[model samples]
Target: MDNLVSVSLRERGGRFHAVFYDPDRGQKWRTLRTSDRREANKRIRIAEDLVSRGDFDPWESPIPDRYATLRGAADLYLAEREKGQLSRNTIRSDRSALGGLCSHMGPAAKVRAVTSDRVKLYFRELIDDECADSTLRTYHTRFKHFFEWCRRERLVRRNPLDGVPRPAVSDALPRFLSHAEFDALVGAVYSDAEAKARGVVDGERSKHTSLHDGDIVWLAEVFFVAVETGLRRGELCAMEWSWVDMASRSIWVPANRRTYSDKDSFGPKSRRSRRVPFGAGSGTEAVLQRLHDETGGKSGPVFVGQRGGPLDGDYVSKRFKEYAGQAGLSEDYVFHTLRHTCASWLVMAGRHLVEVKEILGHASIDTTVRWYAHLDPTRLNAAADATFGRNGDRLRQARCGGR
Candidate 1:
């Protein structure tokens, strides 16, 4: 008993508890859920063996029935999410979405008590609360993971969310700026830059133009780069000077490394690295060349704050909104619209979906096609012509004459 490395038995709440030290998690105190001393001792030995093998998460492996509450399921799910190497954003979002569920159904609600009917009713209430369909779908998606974990762990006989229907998401055409609007937005930024250079001091406008003159010019270039490369906001911000291959006129988007982190551990959302070419006529190459000259070949972020830290994505978005407003664009035109604008223009210019998919770094051609299908004039025309071209008149006449 003394050799078993801090594993000991104790009595708590009329049950024997297995108490031990877990280096990864601090001191762990688990109820044996049995009054028998022999069973408690055996459990302690098992825990010691599990810890030695480096597979001793109290939340996983040989899951116990006591962890059958909604709260327990959530804890276990989040624990697994961490272990599965999910991104921080995904883990944070799951916790938030599931936290709402635990609050609605008391935390103590049994996993076995969660029926499909109960899930359906919960979504009905969410719908009535004026939650957006997309938001409702997200909650449903989170619960689906929880329920699947519960079923796999045998906490529930079946996934209660299995039969629950997800909210129908409307595939509205993505909001994007037209070529004219994009030109106007970029022009506005440069216009302000010109005024700043000329020392036209509009006191109130100064607050809005607080970014350094160089940053204002860079923002204009960012717009050009975004439209040319179609990089995600984070990908663009996380970009480093080294990743920009000026000779090839390409930027390499590295997989899963946080450019904003003190440590370079956080990566791209796509979890994959991709090389995006700067468009031939977008003038992005020249802009990047100027940026390269300005940065003096030192390895740092491609975009940085005035104080010399990496540029924040949110701040960039806020400034873009201000720039768009100055150009008389709609409030709904967001930074992401730059991406959509690029994709739209590509399809409009008769580029194949495969080409668009590669440039945008989309995982699937279906995704590229779905979003930009409307902009592809040839796709629909080709489909119609495939069945109705050249021989269609002859076929129609033969059918009528034969009848």
Candidate 2:
């Protein structure tokens, strides 16, 4: 470890950088990690060693600065995420939440200067703005994670986020459409656009042909598949034609996403999400299969973009909302509602909770149970009726009447 001091750098941002020290006439200045004293000093030693071996083309780090800005850290995090070793959605969320912090603080603000008071204030502002506790918690979680990453990278000496309390949201059961409501929504989709308040279609063909019911019908179909299959939005969008066997009444979820570098990247937000097994009636599966069969075969996407490309999840949600509106539903009831509805309906039909959990592809039966706990009352009522006896009163009356 050579004594490091007297540094000078001409530029800062990726690749070759030179920091000079000692006698100034060394001429061969070593590449510094960054202009920061703490960073340059730490790396100067390593660079000197690397120089001795002639492998001195500096390490080239994703971290631009030791104490990085929220945006910079998130960018680095995203780069690491792009390496395909972690969940893409998780990294995406980290970027989004951390970027929100950058929006509050200036983009170039340093992470070391962040304080517990500032974090507290941010959460308070969230409350004042009427953000949901769940959403607020998401922001805090992202912040906490960023700070932890900072600690590992030695950006800060101590974790200011350590004592921070997390916001608690009620783990309420999901609300789903009733059977009649589900049917009404389905009917609205399969019915006339004008009748369903889906408005009208464009083009000269408007004089005769109508396609208003198409949107709702499709949404309903998508909804049914969600509740029945318990597939996430990302999983549902990735479905291919070959994955469905309507005659056998099954949909195959590959549990992978097509990445920029990797093919069929592991999916479903987890390694366990690698596959989904589900059954659908010919009414839903048949139509989807027929559409693909009519066009080509099992090679292309089952659900395609307007230009016949892969369907993005964002686009699907937008379309799902517009289609759901015809059934007099709110944005509160999005595509995910179909998933809840499926679990709720199954519980209502007297299926076992454990069975429901497995079918839904939940990480734990506890999660499945928690999400549908509101449906427990229905389960309990039937259970009580069967166990306590629907004829308990009759039996008691016979004794009272001295029969």
Candidate 3:
């Protein structure tokens, strides 16, 4: 009662207050609403008993309220998230995950009623529906964030997600295109363009018009830049001509930049800027020069859609899939495969993982190693030979006088 609960009088209001110390929530105060010393003492004793029983939260109500429902708290949580700097996509994902959770667990279910066992059952249902482990992990992450917010807001006594286990996603290697596959993919782009041009000339009914020669060239350059620079689709679409330094052969990917218009705003996924370099002979400079000349305007987006605005990242992925399909590549190949291809090729060419990590703008070297290290078995073999092969044995024998 001494440290866990204390009673104090408000000199100005002439009312008694009950002070309680919660290990998890820290110090909390509750107004006893009585000025009489005897009544305040009785309330203080009750508070002490509640503290001893580990039910000392003053915010918890004896009766169910609107905010006590899962649906109501989730709405408030999402509303608060919308006011922050989080991207719209993040908030949308949060809403999607929460919507599924609310639907599965009855919208009016009490927030406190969501036990760990219930959450485990929900995840089991998701698994039964054949949700991929990666997708399940994303849902789990969103749920964790949502419930943590609820806990901080005192909507629930504790985060139910804390008791639930995270979904286990496999550490599968990233998918990448082989050299022949890469060539075929690029060739497929030109082939499709030519086919469309032929359709236009033959006056055949086609759903889409043929891309202009300049646009075709831009598309090819986009592919080249993606595979070579390992830029994310968002980074590629958001890139500006000014970011390309032809003199230094580097692309300056900014951490975050805001303009007067939201359309022109962009930032790296990691929220850290980096300099991505390209070889002089890698055709990147030539491609940038061609794009610059074709656009006739040097300050706006490096990649633009038919309307000349910033290219949509989602569209880029969809378009890449089309080209991949045309090239007879596996449907699993995605736009991000270009990034994996870049890292894979670099590692195969004897580049250090640290170098690949920097070039790819990865947050950690571990990520670079995890995805590309297995592709460099030659390097590992070479290292092993250098340390324990015939030459190493000879040197050791020479040092030990043939022992």
Q: Any idea how many clashes model 1 has?
A: 6
Model 3 TM-score on a 0 to 1 scale: 0.77
TM-score for each model: 0.71, 0.72, 0.77
Q: Could you give candidate 1's per-residue lDDT for residues 1-403 as a string of tens digits?
A: 2233366688987678776654555666766544557756776677667766666655354424435688876876787686665556677779998888878788689878889998888888888898877788888888888788676555778887779888887778787888899999999898878777655545333434444467478888889888888887877877888788887889988776553744223465556788888855557887788778987746988877766877677778998999999999999899999999989988888888899888887877888878998787788899789987968799999999999
Q: Against the true structure, candidate 3 has what lDDT?
A: 0.77
| Clash-forming residue pairs, model 3 | none
Give the best candidate by TM-score: 3
Task: List the candidates ranked by lDDT, beginning with the highest.
Answer: 3, 1, 2
The 0-to-1 C-alpha lDDT of every candidate, in the order given, reads 0.76, 0.64, 0.77
Q: Taking the tens digit of each residue's C-alpha lDDT, what string does model 2 give over 314-393?
A: 76677667666866876688777877887887787777888787667676777877777667686787788898875889
Q: What's model 1's lDDT at 290?
A: 79
List where candidate 3 sits over 4 angstroms from the true fold: 1-66, 200-217, 257-266, 385-403
* Candidate 1 Cα outliers beyond 4 Å, as residue runs: 1-69, 107-113, 187-211, 255-272, 379-403
Q: Count the backbone clashes (under 3 Å) in each candidate.
A: 6, 2, 0
Error of 3 at 173 (Å): 0.9
lDDT of 1 at 94: 95
Model 3 Cα lDDT, one tens digit per residue, 199-255:
553346566665555655556678899999999877888888888887788999988
